[model samples]
Target: MIDPFGGIKGKELTNTSGFFVDKEEAIKEVNVSIGILENKNIKKPTFLETLRSKKSKNTEIHNNVWDYVPNTNNEYVNIHIFWSKKVVRSKNGVPIRALKVALVGLKAFYRQINTLKPDLQHPDILECYKLSLENYQNLPPIESFISSEKQDLLLDPFAGVTGVDIYKKYNDLKKDKDLTLEEVKYSINFIDQLELPKSKRDKKFITKKPKFVTFTFPTSESYLNVHLWWAGQIIQTRKNIEIGRTRLALASISKFIENIDVETPDLEIEEIKEMYEITKVKHEPGKLKTSRIELKPISKGGLSYWSTKTHRWITGKYDAKNKIFNPPKQNL
Candidate 1:
């Protein structure tokens, strides 16, 4: 494998100045410094250990490491040192030791990169250090890295709305053309009552369910059909209402549903009945025709492109495609 941080020479690796031309050299210096400290029986401080020292106002021992690493004019170098000291003084997890090690390494790396000859300096050198340090500081708790078999369990006693309910409600509403706004509101409430799944670990905890419940459908057409059906029901409640007025009402209701924390008994009902009429007319049987068309590939440079002519229905047979059937279009 290629070393992303160009490999360093033996002389550069052992250089006591702690400066380096690139990241690889900087990292090597950090590791060597950490090793030297360890060899002298100096134990690296843990996150908790440093936290207790700071709370007690005894951070002198922690500051001793700064005396060994050379300070530099580079902003990233100074910032890394500041963060490293802060991490040692406060922060959590085993990664704090890793951060301290990285800070030691960066001190040498930044020193070299900052002092490099104008032509030798890489544009991304400073950016690489900045991003690396940022990512390191944002590291999550170590336990998050561990895999667990635990899965979320549905807290609700009922199985919640399924595809069966979708079709059943659709068919029932189709037969009963007189759908009241109260009935539509009741259906929305029924769906909202369905609780979201909770983790098994949080079984005992009580939490409020989300305002909306996402119902899954077998197909995209079915999802739209269901929402359109509900839209139609809202439309039915008002007779002789203009399509534009009904559309505005439905839009208002949809917006209102999104913002409310709880359902209101006196919630206003709006219109969408005109949309149902338009959709019903467009989807009428025999209005659309389905036919297969040949799609030939274009040739280039005297080479005939290879493509097989496959038969596919490009339009209209709703029943053949297993889609919802629309009402017959009537002459205006």
Candidate 2:
């Protein structure tokens, strides 16, 4: 359990320091400190008993002022205390008790971090300085770095162009000494509309569809004729084949259809073979003549090889030893 503001009783604190005139002033000061904490994303204590009652012995956060665990770091506390105290000092009717209460809040704020890494000097007693308000004011708006129109085309609805992408443009615009923030904001709005599409599926945003009908016949005269003849036979016989001429022929035809765009391009080899009930050995070889083909094994010192001596794969005895599979080349 931690007490952000340690046991600084109002009566004891007033007896030692001239900061607060009375307990009322101390309450006012604590309230203002609570507001500052809330603005910095710290949650204020919500329970009614926290303001009037002491913390339970079993509780972790000893005070009832903060609802959630404070995530603030040292820099924020230093900046907050410096700015708040300066403002507090410039006003009249603020009791010395107010300052004492602020110190209590500061002590609690310091404890938020100090407990994690113990420090000898307390943040409240340390020589604190004021922060620059003008630095934050001069910083550019977040929307200035983000592109609105570019987000429309991206699949992610929240995607935006980074501010760094617009640094040169922003700097160039700033060169005009008379350029006003209002005008800059307007120009940024114009940039947001650039190249943005009205609709997701608009023709203006879509790419041109490709034409699929045009294709030149295969280069090899023998291969082209074989493919055409095989396709004709499959259309006629409609037989399925697992190996040899029928299977090879159908695979070649399917590939050709895929290469050139056609109206009925999806005719798969299996579908065509099923239509004719084509068996692997059922097909007669066409007029095309082919010499015996041999394949070298992929691995060095391996005995496995493939031969196309009879227009079908004739695997060597070493085929059992070779685990790699090499499909037969379609040279037809």
Candidate 3:
């Protein structure tokens, strides 16, 4: 029987896993990412690259937006875009290509169409058109930026911390005629209203992966244990004292973990005393690469090391709790 008086607890949204694709396979990979949406040739590219670069000096694959050659009998259009990020470094004066790398994230969406000025009026390009740039961010948009189509079932695979999913990569290309999102609204619109937070089972990556416990502590004076989660559960522990500077604080924390009991009723117990050390890079994202970590167990002396690209040290602890949560405080 369940205890009706134990007050149900909720977990933070940051514990989910996220999915992403890099520049090279931007189009194809995004199409094959998770679900299949409407697939078609790009209609009109709000921002177009007028210049083309050669394969030797630059590997820009142009001509994704094909022009219908009026041969009186046939009209064929080919759709395949291959633009290189390296093409930005321009060659001397002769003007090799028009480089407009917008911060809008051109790689995220692939619906493009080039409706040139009716083949009649000849107008010069605007000055602002020549002054746009691209901005690369570390996260994706999970809150403010929304999609329009209402999926039958919505899944927020990764939680709140992502931020790069909003802006389009029109690279310096502005809404000269007030286009892009508005036009996209009619074509492949986004669906933001359908986001459902209650359906999440693991509180992170909207998947059915086995819940792993989280055990967090203050890496500093302000790191909060509240913003962290694991296996979709709240973190409850005895000590949330700050871990201080990672380099010097390791010794004391290691000693603490080596001598703690985690099977108690506290929610944050199982994170101490690891069979394998949880190594971390001084302060860099994905720098430690833990998947390749291997430890040699000698009846437990102190710690172990990953024998590869990283020479950093990390310690892992374990307990009998259902899940662990060791979150650092959310910076104010």
TM-score of each: 0.15, 0.14, 0.18
Model 2, 220-283: lDDT tens digits are 2111112232221323332322212222333333333323211122335655333222212232
Task: State the lDDT of candidate 1 residue by residue for 50-103, as single tens digits.
Answer: 776635333222332222212222111111222221221111121222444444
**Candidate closer to the true structure by lDDT (higher is better), 1 or 2:** 1
Cα shift from native, residue 125, model 2 (Å): 1.5
Q: In angstroms, how far off is 124's CA in candidate 2?
A: 4.7
Candidate number achieving the greatest TM-score relative to the actual structure: 3
Go through the candidates in order and give each one's C-alpha lDDT: 0.30, 0.28, 0.24
Per-residue lDDT tens digits for candidate 3, residues 89-168, read 11111111111111112323222211121110000011101111122233232222222233343221111112221222
Q: What C-alpha lDDT, on a 0 to 100 scale, does residue 160 get in candidate 3?
A: 15
Q: Judged by lDDT, which candidate is best?
A: 1
**lDDT, candidate 3, residue 230?**
19
TM-score of 2: 0.14
**Number of the candidate with higher TM-score, 1 or 2:** 1
